[model samples]
Target: MYKVRMRFSKKDFMIFISHLDLARVMERALRRADVPLCFTQGFNPHPKISFATALALGVSSDGEYVDIEIEEKIDLNILKEKINKELPEGIHIIQCQYIDVKSKPLMAVIEYSTYIVRCVLADDVNEDKLNALIKDFMKNKEIIIHKIVKKKNKTREKEINIRPFIRNLELLNKEDCNCIFKMTLATGSKGNLKPEVLIEQLKDRMKISILLDSIRVHRLGLYSIKDERLIEPLEIGR
Candidate 1:
């Protein structure tokens, strides 16, 4: 079997596609494109395709990663081209490469993601005030928030300190009431902090109001920490 890693983009209308549906879509597209897909061994066999992480609903990203095990080796360029042709609009393979099957899974190595968020500031708020608030927010040793977790089919809220998961946050641009910001936060198995969690913290801790309808999140890229540096998922094999 051959292990292949692919980086793809999901945006436009595809942002609404849930992670499970997205997987099904990819399986269908690969079948249509005639890719030689490996199947799991069981009574109900399915393609051996695994995503690095699940993007939040309504969030768009251009740096999603997936691992696929195929029956035989194929040219990376041809594989990308073939998959692109079969993919729906708003979804496209950006990069592809072969990796050793023994390498750690993408979900285990991917550590952080950078995001570009756009939202409308409340009528009473402005750039300077928001910036000041953010400055103070970052100085806290711990930013605690209530998180909902499900266990044994029971759901409950738990208190967690999300400050460590937040690597960086800053204001990028502000035009009239529209504002844009960038953030880098922890992701994957170690500690996953969704962008929405930080947004809610900002609102609650800072006592600020934002236009709910105007909030939008677009993931810029995903990265893994290696040798004390951040690198794209495709660089893992190298």
Candidate 2:
């Protein structure tokens, strides 16, 4: 058996598709393309395909990965072309390659993700106030937020500090009264921080009204943390 890794992009209307549906779509495409996919052994067999990370709903990503096991080796370029023709619009394969099956899984190695957030400001809001709010937010060493935790048969609210999960934040641009920002935050099983939570806290702390419904968030890339350095998932095996 051979292992193949594929990097893909999810954008446009495909952003609304859930992770489960995306997997199904990929499986169908692979079958239509006639790729030699391996299947699990059981009464009800399934393709041996898995995704590295599940992109949250309503969020678009340019960097997504999937691993598949096949029964035979094939020309990667031809495989990509065939699959691309079978895939629907807004979902495209960017790159593909063979990888060591013994290496760590992509989900386990992901430690951080970078995102670009474009905030649609209210008519009365100004850039100076937004800048001041961001400055104030960075000044504090810890920002506490209440989260619901489940224990046994009961659920309770727990206070958690999100400062440690935030690695970097900066304003990218201001145009036509809209503010764009870039953020890098902890992700994966270790500790994950959602960008929406950060924005909610900022609005509360600064007492600024924003068009939360109009905000757009796009995930740029996911990375692995190693020795105080950020590494891309594709670099792990090489």
Candidate 3:
């Protein structure tokens, strides 16, 4: 048996697809690619594959990741070739290799993620002055806001202190009134900060009129948590 790490991207029309549907599609693609995947010995056998963070709906990514188990050792290059050949246009296999990751879980190791949010302002966007406010806000020890506690279809009223999850937010580049925001997301037991909530806080407090033609978030890299510190997930084993 072998443990394999496969990094792929979700883009194009596939971004509109839900994570569950993506999982199902990839499973079929692997089969077509002739991957010697390991399966649980149950009444119904299924490929042993796991996804880190399920991208929220309507988001595109160039750095999404998923891990799978294989029954036999295969050449990494061939595996990549076969998978890429079979994978649909939107999903592409960026990397694939065997690793000593038997005990580690992909979802558990993910500590922080980076995303690029595409937004257009409703007005001239006084970004020079607005950026200063964002910088100062990130420095504060405590920032509180009301959050919807999702129970099912309905979300309850609640107050969430964003200090725990948000590590940083920066405006990378802007063109023609469209702004690109790179944000780091929280992972593990500390929970995660949804992008919509952050945007809400910005609108309510920072007074930025961000209209979304599209919002794209990519899981840049996964990290392992240690003693309240962050480390790369691949450090578990090369």
Which candidate has the highest lDDT of all? 1
Query: What is the RMSD of candidate 3?
Result: 2.6
Q: Which ten residues in a row have the lowest lDDT in candidate 2?
A: 121-130
Clashing pairs in 2: none
- Per-model TM against the reference: 0.92, 0.92, 0.88
RMSD of each: 1.8, 1.8, 2.6
TM-score of predicted structure 3: 0.88
How close to the true structure is residue 181 of candidate 3, measured as C-alpha lDDT? Answer: 81
Clashes of 1: 0
Model 1, 1-238: lDDT tens per residue? 9889999999999999999999999998899989999999989998889898899989999999999999988998999999999999999999998988888888988999999988886775777998999999999999988879999999999999999999899999988878788999999888988887788788788886767677899999999988868899888874
lDDT of 2 at 153: 89
lDDT for each of the candidates?
A: 0.90, 0.87, 0.76
Error of 1 at 16 (Å): 1.2
Q: Residue 47 of model 1: what lDDT?
A: 88
Quick one: ranking by lDDT, best first?
1, 2, 3
Q: What would you estimate as the lDDT of candidate 1?
A: 0.90
The C-alpha stretches of model 1 lying farther than 4 A from their native spots are 124-126, 150-156
